[model samples]
Target: MVSIKEGNSPDTETLILEAARKVFIRKGYDGARMQEIADEAGINKALLHYYFRSKEKLFDQIFLAAFKDFWPSIKSELEQGDGSVKCLIRAGVNAYTDMLMKTPYLPAFVVSEINRSPERMEGLLQASGVDAAFVMAVVQRGIDRGEVLPMDPRSLLINMLGLVLFPFISRPVLSRLFFDSEEAFMSFVGQRRQEVYAFMCRAVLHSSAL
Candidate 1:
């Protein structure tokens, strides 16, 4: 086990973070212990503390890192492009769904932890800088451009996200409901990845046409 040394290589921080991410994903935040993280990092618990003061702090770093990874694609899509609202929505939908697929445990972890600590949600919201207003502006632009049918932007955004996220979040139940076994459900999900994008595009186009 190689330990991360201080006053030397900054690359060691990345190693610690990668190790912590693995442990957290495997054991979950609540189930993960400091000693486990230390062992995974190949460092002493004291050194772990030196890098990240507490379990909560370490988890926060992981959470923020995950959030940043998820957020930038959508934000960049919005800020860039030719100001095509439909394109923005499509890009955002793809980015968000892709992130969810890559990090399936993310939603469950964030939602559960936020539920336990309501105040944390506010900080997260502020940090992400994504609120109802921003989503609504995107939807409103689509409406103005006659690219989407008239509807409450908030409701539309919610519905879109729900359609994309609920299936993944409830994969176990959804799998059982629609398929005979877990394997079948996963296969279904793999197929639905494309289906979801197509469905979303059609739904938005249909709404705009109406």
Candidate 2:
């Protein structure tokens, strides 16, 4: 896990995007300022503006970068294996949890922006190459083979996502309320990769598959 502030090997655009991602995760869309991103990247605001014209454009680029970084590997993982419903769930949970652990603020940032500007985010998501229908089809195939219980693919998808997302999104309250320290909270979150996998199995797997 390289620090966002790693070696000066990255170009100026890469620096701005990494800096903007940190700022956006900390301050969110409306709250973030271009100057703050420049300061984070140790560049002048004029230079930052030279690269990205506006905060909206910067935010979009950051989200797109995250989606690009995330979706491809997970897509490969989902495409592999026995193509079982449980396998799909396992791959998704494991991949998402691992990514969230590395960038814990990502889910909250994405969710916040979507609520703030769903139309814009929808366009961005459409560009992200997340094949939801393919994932749903995996579940449908499992049901067709009598491997999982008959369930609405959409509902099952939402169920799996909710299980993976809730803890990270609710981090502030959950960290304080349920755990003594950030370390404890993160330890629990690390464990959730397996926990979520087991929970999804119980939620969707048929008796024989279980």
Candidate 3:
């Protein structure tokens, strides 16, 4: 969420956000402290409180921004009939992988919260105005048009979510077991973006579509 371009001086709010993101990535929601974030930003606690009254509000702001950055504008794409289902799949997977590369700890943080309180986050997607029926209808149209295999939209969506999230969820164990170093693990993740797109294409797209 720290979107300041190279060589630009970040404003105080931007600095705070960047510092909070780093602290959240390191300590997670429960472990992160407001004072820690202020220290990370090289600012005093009073100033931090003036900008963000509470830890929850600050964390919510950062997490929500990250989520928005993570999700593609597929709703608009489908509405405009801008791309085939396969194309959308590829774009979505690419976007997801790229976002994870930038915010590697996000999936773990979300999964931890969901495990702690399932009801707390159950309505997030709905609250975001992502209509399940509308997305299903779009997928159904792809099936009717033979752009993809005749699979249930729910199954396709769940599978895509699993495929995209599993790597990040298991990164701690997988990184230790499969990679020699942090750089190697990151390199593998970078390569897996294309692999995920290709795999999903095979899983859902018709031969002609591929």
Candidate 4:
């Protein structure tokens, strides 16, 4: 693939990153080889090493970026939004699904890597910079105002995340049973941008309104 450059050629780091994302997505972390990444970037292994001393480091860079896609900087996602409980849930589903729509393997990659190293969870969550208290406060306000159900904010977040990610993670199986082909499965997901938000309405919005 050609490196997307404006007037000048893409820098070596950008090429390496883009190439690494493709290989990591296609091969997963375990299966991706540094040499393969080098070839993909049209660079020699020595130069690849010069840029990223090791595969783990390169994967770390990509993994952190991918994690951001799943859960963007908490400040940006949490602070800039409507802050209503239902709107937050709806936005999360939309952001996650939209992100996965572009990179279908991201959720699977994240799940695999996290499971491969459960010890990293604490540091990863810490690195997220998301204040649980702040998010709960948002949920609490919704509850107080009767805009949200009396549920733990964390549980609601998990369920909302699952609703968005599971479809992408299960795409292959879903294709076999629910849809006739990968194309059809993705088509359904494309249509789900609004459908998933509407589903969130039932969970947080009053049933009488529907």
Question: For each candidate, C-alpha RMSD in Å?
Answer: 3.8, 5.0, 5.4, 4.6
After TM-score superposition, the amount by which residue 58's alpha carbon in candidate 3 deviates from its true location, in angstroms, is 2.1
User: Model 3, residue 102: displacement in angstroms?
Assistant: 2.7
Clashing residue pairs in all predictions, respectively, total 3, 0, 0, 0
* Residue 7 C-alpha lDDT in model 3: 41
Better of 1 and 4 by TM-score: 4
- Best candidate, TM-score-wise? 2
| Segments in model 1 whose C-alpha atoms lie over 4 Å from true places | 1-8, 75-85, 180-183, 202-210
Per-residue lDDT value at 99 in model 1 = 84
Task: State in Å the error of residue 28, model 2.
Answer: 1.0
**C-alpha displacement of 109 in model 1, angstroms?**
1.9
- Please report, as a residue range, the 10-residue window in candidate 4 with the lowest summed lDDT: 1-10
lDDT tens readout by residue for model 3, 1-210: 346665434577789999998898688888898889999999888767778778888887876665555455555444455557776676667667767887787887767755766775646665455455766776788899998898888888778878988878888898899989878888888888788888888989889988
> Looking at model 1, which ten-residue stretch has the lowest summed lDDT?
1-10
lDDT of each: 0.72, 0.81, 0.76, 0.77
* Ranking of all predicted structures according to lDDT, beginning with the best and ending with the worst: 2, 4, 3, 1
Candidate with best lDDT: 2
Model 4: pairs clashing at backbone N, Cα or C within 3 Å: none
In candidate 4, which residue ranges exceed 4 Å CA deviation?
1-10, 73-82, 208-210
TM-score for candidate 2: 0.88
Q: Estimate each model's TM-score.
A: 0.78, 0.88, 0.79, 0.84
- What lDDT does candidate 3 reach at residue 1? 36
